[model samples]
Target: MEDSRDPQFASLSVGDSAVAVLVDRATDDADVIHDIELMTCSEYSHLCLGMPSDDTGDLAMYTNNKEMHAEDRLALWPAFHRDRLAADGRRFADEGYDFVVQHQVGSRFVDYMNHVGESTFGTPMPESLSVVEKFANTATTSHYLVLHQALMERRIPRGSKILMVPAASGVVTGFLSATVSSLEV
Candidate 1:
């Protein structure tokens, strides 16, 4: 797999069963990403959701057109399954684990979600296929959430650690947002 990381400045770590991980940090080189020592596999878990960067931006902006108000933005969000997305975030929390959504900012999902909201609603919006392109980056993020929940339901202990590698920063942030919302102080 060439480790999927650049060879020149990459690092490595061998964990249980000889699991090898290569980390590509903000730096131009790879750093050895090791197990989060403070946490255990049973205490924490991660979901790596993909964040699509194609249409979410334009759609969100188009949905929240300059003329739209907060109420309007809110309206469009639910229209394009924004509630469903939020619900998905809730789902991760219900299972007692945090998520790590990774997606690039400036991309569709991030761009709009970051500002106004998702469109895909209204009387005559874009087709489902076009809307889906915006979510391409989110598949991995959602997958991680689902998997994390499943593991916790099976009694994965709190503080256990799970690794979500090579996903967009947005995905990781989404997961964290979901987790924070679900936990009680």
Candidate 2:
């Protein structure tokens, strides 16, 4: 898993689109990685779902449970609003990165990465949306598709730096940051 990035790409980010998170997993000794933050448990109400039946005998209502599961997914959104990612992206900009890599799950996430990139550099930046556009979503491997697209398009400039923000779930909510170079990846 420690292989270098794929192309002249800047970075790669992965994970679920929900659950706001703040994490910096970049290391100076290594190439920067493109990553993201996501959580398996979204709504606080998601925490309320599928509990082991209480000995008190409360039968789980199928419809109610489903509704709760669906409606309560944004419970963690407050933490990762556009402003937060904007702020973090700015911090990345300040760190001297030239571009960013992100997950391409769909248009919303694509637009989101654009928003964050725009807010970070105070200008338009290249997006990694082509992968999702062409291949739809590949779940955890979506970032790789993005990197592959970046390589094919030659969008990344050699020696440029990139940022990543990835997501994860399964009861865990966090992010990993890494700096990657286009020349190497």
Candidate 3:
């Protein structure tokens, strides 16, 4: 569905006077999450990413047997991004945002350290051994953080609407890599 009310967005065209806010789901993917951090280091970019927190108590839905802990939540990043990124990418490009803000996953919990094996000299490695397994989770957090900073810097107007294009078509159409202007003009 196309959203027409919001002025601030990620990838659409902002009228000469309108303020565009480009929001990317930073924690959505590993590559894009990395990109956000690279972009941020160069200069203070105006963008925002939404960070998922336990505030909603929805984390429980992810893990059925155990209460959703921080580690469990981190594990969900890859699937979450795989599920959501394409749609969001389309939104940013189609939205013509003036600024982009997003976040990727950040540090993990101590419990997550189990992934790593026994440390050298009887000391245990602080983190998981197969950190690659956690990359998606951490990346998700990174994206969220980067995007959050971006949003805070360039706050979108309260009433600005967001347009989210469906994912199935975006993936089918090869729209993921295209920038905001590249979308159907």
lDDT of each: 0.27, 0.45, 0.25
Off by over 4 Å in 2: 1-90, 116-129, 168-177, 182-185
- Provide the global lDDT of candidate 1 against the true structure: 0.27
Off by more than 4 A, model 3: 1-68, 83-185
Q: Weakest 10 consecutive residues, lDDT, candidate 1?
A: 8-17
Cα lDDT, model 2, residue 30 = 53
Which candidate's lDDT is highest? Answer: 2
List the RMSD of every prediction in angstroms: 19.3, 12.0, 19.3
lDDT of 2 by residue, 1-185 (tens): 12322221111233233332234654454555544555555443333333323342533311132232232332233245334556665443355555555544465665665565466446565434346667765556655556556757787665555554443323333344445452333
Q: Model 2 Cα displacement at 85 (Å)?
A: 10
| Per-prediction TM-score | 0.18, 0.46, 0.18
lDDT string for model 1 (71-108, tens) is 43323433333344454563212332222222221245
In the range 1-185, model 3's lDDT, one tens digit per residue, is 12422212212211212223465554433223121201111121112222232444321111111222234333333233333545456222233323321121123332342221122112332211122223433322332333333345444333232221111101110111212221111
